[model samples]
Every structure is written in C-alpha cells, then in structure tokens.
Target: MRDYPNDQNLQDLQERYHLFAHMDAAIIDAERDKACPEGPLQDLVVGLKANIASIGANWSAGLRHRIAITAQSDAHLTKRLRDHGARILPGLNMDAAALGGGTDNPDLGRTANPHAPDHSAGGSSGGSAAAVATGLCDVAIGTDTLGSIRIPASYCGVFGLKPTFGLIGRSGIVPLAPSLDTVGILTARAGDVWPVLQALAGPDGGDTDSQPAPAQWANQTATPDAQGLRIGIPQQVSTVECTPETLVALASARTTLEQAGAHVETIDMPEWNPAKLRQKAFLMTEAEGAATFAEALGTAGTLPRTVERLLTYGSTLSAAKLVAGMAEIRAARVQLARSFAQVDVLLMPTTPQRAFQADAPAPANQADFTALANAGGVPALAVPIEVAGQALPASVQLVGPAWSEPRLIRLAMVLESAF
Candidate 1:
C-alpha cells in the first residue's frame, strides 16, 4: 500500500476548502490495509462523495445528524477501486441531503471553488470536483442526479463523466432519486477517467441497477476517431439564455469538431424541453428523497429546513401528478433515443453560466441543459473549454445514447486537444 506522509497537508487543504465531510488518519489507515498493489489504480488517491459508503468513515450523505454513523462495509464501487489499487480518502462534504445546486452545507460548510475562492463549486457533488481541482486527490467519486457531477466539473474546470445509467453500480450510494442517481468520476486529466471507470464499472449483484457490459463496450479495443462522426447540437440550446462566454465556447467546440472532419449540425428535437424535463426530474428527486429519508424527516435536527421543506412539498404531490411527471420524463427519453438515431452525439454547454460567487443566489436554470441526460439515462461527459480573457473556464458536454461512454470520452479528448 502507498503511504500518505502528507496527511497534514491534505487535512489543511480540506479545512481551507471544506472539501471533506470527514478526514482522519484512522480512515486512511484502514483503507491502506485493503489496497491492492498490482491493480490499475495502484498509487492513485481517490476521494468519495459523502453518500458513498466506505468502512471506518462517516456515511451521513451530508445530513447533520447522521454524521456519527460509520459505514460497516465499503460501497461496491469503493471496494472495486480498492481492489484495483486506489488509496481511498475520507468521505467528502456535499449539499445537505443532496438537495441544492450550491455546495453550501448548513452543517458541514461550503465547498469553495479552487479556481476562484469567492465562487461556488456546483452542487451535491461539488466537494468531489473541488478536491480533484485542488489536487487533494487524483480522482473523486460523485453521484449525479440531474447534473450534479457535470455542473461541478464545469464550474471547477475539471473532467467529469456521468456514465450510462447502471453502467456503474449504486449498491452503497444513498438514494436521492433512484431513477436518476448515477455514480461517476471526476479527474484532473481526461485520460484518468477511463482507467478509473474500467476499474469500478461492471455487474454487481448487490445493486439492482447494475448491468453487464454491453458487447460494444466489452469488445472496444481502440479509441474512436473524430473523423466523420455525426455531431448534433439541439435547436433548443438556442432558446436557453447563456452567457456570451458559454456561447462562444460552444461555437468553438463545434468548429474544432468540424475541423476534425466530424459532421456538426443543428438538429430539431421538439420533444426534448430542458426546462420542463428538469422540473419533472426535480419532482422525482424530491419525492423519492422524501421516501428515502422518511424516518429522518420526523426527527428535528436530522435535516435542514430547506431540505425539509422540499421533501414536505414532495410528500404533498398527488399520486396522479407523480405518475404524470414520470410519463413526461419517459416521453422525453423516447424523444432523445430517436434523436440519437440521427446523430452519434448531442453537444451543448454543461451549464448556462460560469461559477457564480459563493454568496450569490443559486441559479434556477443551472440544470436546464444537463437534466436531459439524466432523464434519458444516457452518458454525458463534461470537459472544460478555455476561453481567452475569461477569469473562469466555460464547459461543454457530449451526450450520447446509453453505453456510449467510450465515444464520449474519445470525443472529449479531441475537444480537449483543440483548447
């Protein structure tokens, strides 16, 4: 096992940035005993979102009262990583109960953007992104339920991948929205994503959501070339109000893909409405979250007021309304599948704006562009785009049909090379 002689420095950074929910030498020591010396992730350090369980560390899922509860066993993905040689760090902080877009936890603390200390790190998975950006860890595991992983990746200028739903096991992850929650990775380098993904993805009996690798994924031997790939930019993207920098970054990415011989065009996907889909997805999250934390909702200090309010609203949703919302989301997924028939990938900005000030009000439209992938249970990769004269990096995402993670990552590499 690799030794962590700089544990003090790690702790100092965690305190400075509020990156971890719990970081102790005892936790690291326990993980070291389980590390594999001959695996793919050997010597790599990884931090996990608070929701993912790791034995000997707290597994509160960012709730204030559950902070004292320790995980009895490693999460399926955590075990896979340890078996593949990754040195697991303590659990990272997150939005309280994973309800908000900003990582301002009323209990633990706010996770500040490493790129700009005054700015916000996008939510739920914000700590995971910040840890990777600040070099606190080589890789971080995050759970994405409606843009959680990609938003933070965009804001923090790191690479984030929300793999095809069920591609990665969710056995030990705390549920927010079972239909939307997906375990994914965030890393400093685009290349690091695949190796870690390879280590953690596969069928898991413990997780009902897990599935066997598709033939295309298992037999994949070479990275796909950008030449002649069909790239589509949805017409709805024009309807969203994006910052000038974000728009420019999207345009530049189009030009880069075009130069690489890819066929880039604007495609009309009338059935796909990002705003409507996001609302539907949020309802599902809140409703499902209420059920997941039913017992805690009765306790006084187990959850924050905002989370309690959201869950209460979800609990009040009529059964018919919930069914209607699920139907609409399913319809949206069908529309997305049909669109994929015409294009290999869909390109769009990860978020409409760059990272806002930590103290600023969180934008309601943060997930407008990102919820489509989650609703459709597809793979989406977010990569930072460097825009000249801009203080923060703008980001673009590539979304594809289910099990298309390999293509998305290869395309991201091509896009990464351009900037």
Candidate 2:
C-alpha cells in the first residue's frame, strides 16, 4: 500500500506548498511509522494547527518568541489521526493563540490564501485551511471557538466541519475560549470529510465538555435521518449587511438545493442578529479567555497586543454584564433550536463576503453567520461552492441542532453536489 513517505502524490503536494510552520522530517517520519496502512485513512497527510499538540513537535501556538515547550505527548486528536493511518504534519501557523478571524501570525509568519496569496485565509486555522486548499496535505485538524475552521474554509475554497461543542474532544488543544472551543476537520476533497471524522469523533478523558461520542460516522455519507430533511434559512440572516457577492452566492446555492429536491424554506429567527450575536459571543469568549490566561495576566506586557487587549477587557467585565450575556445566549440557543425544530437543518452564508485582502480589517460581521453554530453548541458544515466564473471562493454554512452531525453531513452532501 502507498504510504506517506512513499506516496508520489504526497511528495508532490509538499514540494508545491509552503504551508507548514514546522514540517520536521523526523517528527513526520515518526508519525508515519505509527500509521496503520490497513486503517481507514490510508496514505493521508494531515496538517495539525500549531495549537493542537503533537508529541516531539514544536508546540508554540505561534508565539512571538520560541518557548521551550514541546508536546511531549500526542493530543487526543493527533493520536486518533495517526492510529487511523494519517501522517501527522504538526506546527501550522495560526492567528497567534487562535485569537482572531484572519490567519495573520507574527511569530510564525502570515499564512497565504491558497486561492489568493495577497488575501487573508480567514483564520485562526488559516494555515490548516490553506494547506488543504493548496494540496499541501489531504486534510487538516483545526480548532473553532467562533468561526476559526469554517471561515478559512470559505476563504480557501475547501470544506470545514465544526461538530457539536462537546462532540470532539479538546484535551490538548490550546484554549481560545474553553466554553466555546471545538476541534474540527478541514478537507481538500469533500468525500473524505466523513471518513476522517469517523476516526476522530469521540469523548476524551480530560475534556470537561466531552459528551457521548458520536456513532453516526456511517451516516456522514449516508442519507438523512428517518424523517425527510428540511433546510431552513433564517429571516434575520437575510437582513444582515453583506457584500453583493455574498447575497448572490447565497441565492445561487439556495436555488440549487431547492431544485435538487430538498425542502427549502425561510423561517423567522428574530433573536439571531449577526452583530448582536457576535457581541454576545465576544463577551462569553472574553470572560473565559481572561480566566484561561490568568497566569499571563500578571506579566501582561509580554503577551500579544490583541491577546492582552481582549484579556484585559475580559478581566474587567462587570459580573452582572457577563451574567446577563450568558442568560441572553442561553435564551438565544433555545430560540435558535425552536427555529431548527421546524427544519432538519439551517443554511446561511459562511462569511459576509469572500476572502478579504490580508491588510483589510476583517468584516466586523465576518463570523456573524458562522458563530451561531458555535454559540448555540450545535453542529455546522461550511462547504465551498463555486459561484459560476468567480475566481474567489464563495461558501455557505449548514447548521443543525446539537448532536445533529449526521443530519448536517447529509445536508452538506447536497451542497457538495450543488457546488
């Protein structure tokens, strides 16, 4: 059987793409040695976001200076990928500490968009998304608290899936917002998303949020659940300010799905405003982030400005405000679920627009659409669809209720065909 070191395709991809932060020969070879050729993911090259720890690899999550830290042991996700026959390529660049949406890292260098190097690779997992889209690796492991995985997938023109909050284990990954953190997959080829997910979906001993592992991998590529699948487009999403290009892409994709025999309908979800939803997400993220970085709080100047700024703000938030935000989010989640109760899945634009320039500040509403899934603790699938003749990638998100990964994947297959 073809293996990582022996596969001509893998060798070719490595030569053509400069996507890794630390692609050490020894670390990769060591992982390759542990791969099971007989496993489901034979011959696959997997990129690990720098934050996802890997034994013996440089473990800094894109820090300005090299810290003398290495992942003395493989993270749960890392071990799972290798055990399932993937050659783990660790240390890909990310927004320093996975703090923001754009994949611009100072310590590890900014990741170039595979489709447009001059543009941003919607980030935090920017390196992983670029690596897959550029063919550097077959798939990548990325962590998403907000839209980290999906935004980059939309920007890079690939597929990214953020399963339900507690579905995938988050044991060794560096925390951005522990309460919202979710580890997920990014794939070059849509067909492989399920198989890779099959190998990795499960609870970890250490992840406090870990719930019952999913048993629906078979359904990832299977037909929708027992009932007829219903796809919903929220009314609020329609009113959000978005680029004309995104509006066009959303219309095009929706039309295609409807034509493909799926029941597509618009549902009212007044509580789900993109910007307000983001603010609530920010409040929750900051509060948890401040606690996560409590050790670094004492030596604030040493931290990155963005990290420090967010942490500082998070530290000072009035307890009543945080409490109010949490209550509001909880109500929003319940309200969002009621919207889902009418449909088996929900559809929305993954980002407000296609990839932005590297220098352009991210659209304040960039994660507006995608963060709904993260905030609600539901599953979301971001599929890149070709908007006829457009060179830039346009993508849409498919969201489902918590633990509805199977249904979400089923819907993703439809978008995959339409794209």
Candidate 3:
C-alpha cells in the first residue's frame, strides 16, 4: 500500500533532532550466557528518551529538563526492571524539547528509516521507533502528545500506542504539553506490547491524571468467532492526500478483518477544516509547552531557535482564545465519544501521506491525523498496515471511551494480526 525506503528518504529528514544522542553503548557479541545471572528482564534492553532523567546526568531543572525528568523517573523504573531482570540503556533525544522536529545525530545518522535509510524515522519519538525497528532493543519508551508515538510508529513500520491520557503516569517524562503528554511504548511484535503495558499501566500517585483501567476491561468482549467486529470506516478520509498504495493497503486491511470474521461499516464524521483544527490544536499545545518550559525559557539567555520561536508563539495566545479552544475541544470530545457507541473501533489512514524526505524538516501540518485522540482523552494505537513491495505502515487508530485501553489494544491486535 505505502512504500517509503532508501537513503534519500533518510537524508530528507535529518534537519530536526540529534539522533546520535541516544543509542546502545554496550555491545554484546552474542546472547547472554545461559548460565549467567539473569533477572525479570534479563533478555531485554530498554531505550530511554534523552528527556527522561537518570543518575549522573540527572538534572530535572536544567535547560532541556526532559532528560532529568526521565532519569529521575527511570531510577524507579530501572530498579523495578532490575528487580524483575532488565537493563536500561541510555536515553534518546527528540525534536528539540520534544517538538516533533526529527533528529540530528550523525553517527546513527539522524534516525532515518530502517527499512530505507534515506527516509526519516518519525518524531518526536523518532529515536524510539528507530531503536525498536532496527532490532537494537526489544522495547523502548516514548512520549506522545498528539501523535508523537503513532506518527513515528507509522513511519518506521512498528507498533505504537497512545494510551488513554492519564492511564500511564507522566511524573518522570518531560512536560511537552503536560495536560496532553502521555508516556507510551514501541515494539516489534503486536503482542509484545502487553508485557510492558502490564508493568507500567498503573498509577504512580504523583500524576493526578493516571488511572488504570479495570482488569475486566482488559478482556475484550468482542469475539471474532461469535460475530464480526463492527469497524467504522470514516468517509472523510477518502481523498488525494492518501497515496494510492495507502488507500489500497487500508482497503486490504479492512478486507482482512472481514475475512477474520469482523463486520465493517462506513461512518461519516463532522467534516474538519484541517488548517483551522491544526491551528486550534497548536494553540493548546504551544501554550501548555510554554508553561512547562517556562523555567528553561526564563533563565537561558537564548534557546534553540525552533523551540524559542514555538515558545514565543505559544506565549502570544490570548487567554480568551485559549479558553475558546478548550471549550471547542471539550465539546468535540463529547460528540466523538458518543460516536464511538455505534462502533467497536474507528479506522482511518494514519497520515494519508508517505514518509517525508529524511533531510527535510517535519511537515508543518504533520499532526492532522493524530491529535483528535489527545483532545478526546481516548486510547489510540497505530499498527503497521500493509504498504507496497516494501513495508510502509498506514495507521489505523482505535480509540475507545476513557480508560478503555484494554479493549483498544485487543481490537488493535486483531487488525495487526493480518500483517
């Protein structure tokens, strides 16, 4: 369906972040010795985002405070993993300050597409996606505010889920847009997600937003054999923005679901003005980001050009406009939730477009396909759908009512099963 590969693609997306900042430092020639001492995660190596804080370099109050936040949170995470038996690798960087800009690391070479080195690895979780896709690690953590997790996942041909906001605590993650920011995971296999999810799904007490869904919700009610799933296909998604292969892949995925015994239906939604919605979305994000990074912005004589500009733009949003945007989001969320009542999950093309050139800056309008979930406080997962001769993943976001991650993941498992 979608085909994105090669060195050109990689070179096309390197303008954003420093990709080399985070990678595996320890190299093991072979698997761990069978007789070697092992713990719970003895077989796994976890990748941390540079934004997360850790022991020596830990400084949550620094100019780019994300690393410190992650390091601090990871201290607990590391102990828990070690007790269980896992190793925590160094943290990776994102578009500066997690702005979704891509990376600039030269050695690893800007987190380019693993399938095709010329293309890009998506962001702000680009590095995480790169790390996982390349088999450098079994699992890696990322932050999603809007579509950070899903976008890169789609680009890199991996599995990414932005759990219902608050389901995963953000105490240790950097505050991109604190209200919307959520910690998420990227993995090779669809089923592999469960282990990490189980480990980090509960509340941490510090984040007022965190609330794990009940276990019963984790067991999906919809059974494939009893009857087919009621999947809603949004009509608004049919357009030129989606490449031929993307459309084809989505159609094929739908067909596969049907063959698997899931029922599918076509649904219509409030037509959105992509540009206006993007503007409103940015207002909320930039404003929240400005507040989150206020300390860094105030003390630092100068900040990264892009970050400073974004922060400045965020600062200019009038309180009145911000309030109006919030109201719009709340009202929209209510309607969207009601819409889900008729369908188990809603399916659509994740980005409707192909991966950008690796050397180019992240598309200014990149978030169009992924932000609604953040606005709605729903859980959405991006699973790799078929692409072209090569594999280019088209996203099918499954969003359920608040705290419905269990159901969401189950539904996604079925969709990804075809691949």
The 0-to-1 C-alpha lDDT of every candidate, in the order given, reads: 0.88, 0.79, 0.65
Of models 2 and 3, which has the larger lDDT?
2
Error of 1 at 374 (Å): 0.7
* Model 1 alpha-carbon miss at residue 333, Å: 0.7
For residues 121-152, write the lDDT of model 3, one tens digit per residue.
Answer: 77877887877777666777788887888888
Residue 96, candidate 1: how far off, in angstroms? 1.4
RMSD of 2: 2.7
RMSD of 3: 5.9
What order do you get sorting by TM-score, best first? 1, 2, 3
lDDT at position 86, candidate 3? 53
Badly placed stretches (over 4 Å) of model 3 are 1-42, 57-83, 104-109, 218-227, 271-275, 299-301
1-419: candidate 1 lDDT, tens digit per residue: 22442768777887789898767677776665664577878878888999999887899888888888888998999889888878887688799877888889988889999988899999989999999988878999999999999999999999999998898998987889888898999998887788888888888888888887776575553253688899999999988889999999999999999998899999999987888888888999999988988898888666899999999889889999899789879988999989999999999999999999999998989999889999899999999999898779999999999988878888888888888
lDDT per residue for candidate 2 within 178-250, as digits (tens), equals 8888999998766677788778877699898888754644454544332355788888876778878787878
Model 2, residue 306: what's the lDDT? 79
